[model samples]
Target: MTSAGSTGWNVVQLADIPATPWRNGGGVTRELAMWPDAGDWAWRMSVADVDKSGPFSKFDGIDRWFTVLEGAGVQLDVAGVLHRVTAGDAPLFFDGAADTGCELIDGKTRDFNLMVRRGSQPSKMVRVEGRHSETLNAMKTIAVYAHHSPARVLFDEEVLQLAHATLAWRMVTGSAAVGIAAQGALWMEIPA
Candidate 1:
């Protein structure tokens, strides 16, 4: 991850982030960003490359947003309810405290995840295609991730070119307009 000058912005390239193997030996995760940058972070973002089906780690009192990024997709069982999620499909929001398990549809899959502790702050994540433009909220943190393709972001008089699987996050205070041009991506709004 690299800082974007002194704008309170950080740019994360998935290829540059190292992966950490899972204890279950089913997957490896690359953490994209985390608040506090230390112990007991309030929120964290990551991408997981799953090679097999397995149970997910339970994070009590946390809310989660999940999306399939690549591969054949997955069959997820969340609290006894089965949900089939594929790439380009709508995102799934579930309680992180639930007994959740992921079963790959075919062989391998990559997924994006956002976890935030309960009561810390509310967050919103959504899939973005085509062009998206919105006014920023001064009280909230904002991030735009380019998934599988290159994307462009316009803020003030600046333009940020985001490569595939890249995330551009702004953590500083203040509000400004942001215009994102992405083929397929994720837009996140969280606590600053």
Candidate 2:
């Protein structure tokens, strides 16, 4: 099952959110992702600030997402059930094997995360600002994350480009129709 725009995704840069002591009590910087399909089915990205504290552990074939890039509260706790997230809303799923924690409220914050596994399938995160079109199947893969200014993805003719926080392509087959010539902000993934 690999027709209608056959697979493509590139634009990953991470590894810069480390100092310890809760990121020196302020100014937390992150990226540390870009697995590029290798081994234990991995994919990770990070960005966090504002009263930062963390307790993230659990990966039995991962599957998770938490997005809040800016400010307006943030709180997450899986296995105990507690979620209060803001900043563009909608993208809070759990069960990455359970047991996770985080709590933040006030100013200074940025967030984006994706952990994929569970037998190399089942993955979805959405937040696209402009032009759109969809349809992909076959081992599945689609990931596009950019926020305003710098966009262009047309699967079925082959064209992958992105800017403004670039988290470009990742498609694994057939049916295309995703356009964004202006208004940015995006995140798309399919892996079931």
CA lDDT of each prediction against the hidden true structure: 0.87, 0.62
RMSD of each: 1.6, 13.8
Top model number, lDDT: 1
Q: How many clashes (backbone N, Cα, C below 3 Å) per candidate? A: 0, 12
Candidate 2 residues 1-192, lDDT tens each?
A: 111233445565323235233534544545444455335445665554545656765678577787786677678788888898876677887778898777776655677777766554567786666676665545556666665467777767667765566665554655555555536565657564
The TM-score values for the models, in the order shown, are: 0.93, 0.32
Q: Give stretches of model 2 more than 4 Å off.
A: 1-62, 72-95, 105-117, 120-138, 148-150, 156-171, 174-189
- Tell me the TM-score of model 1: 0.93
Q: Which pairs clash in the backbone of model 1?
A: none
lDDT of 1 by residue, 1-192 (tens): 655655556899898899999999999999998887747887889999999999999999988999999999999999999999999688898999999999999989999998888776678888888988878756777888899678898887688888988988886367788888889989888875
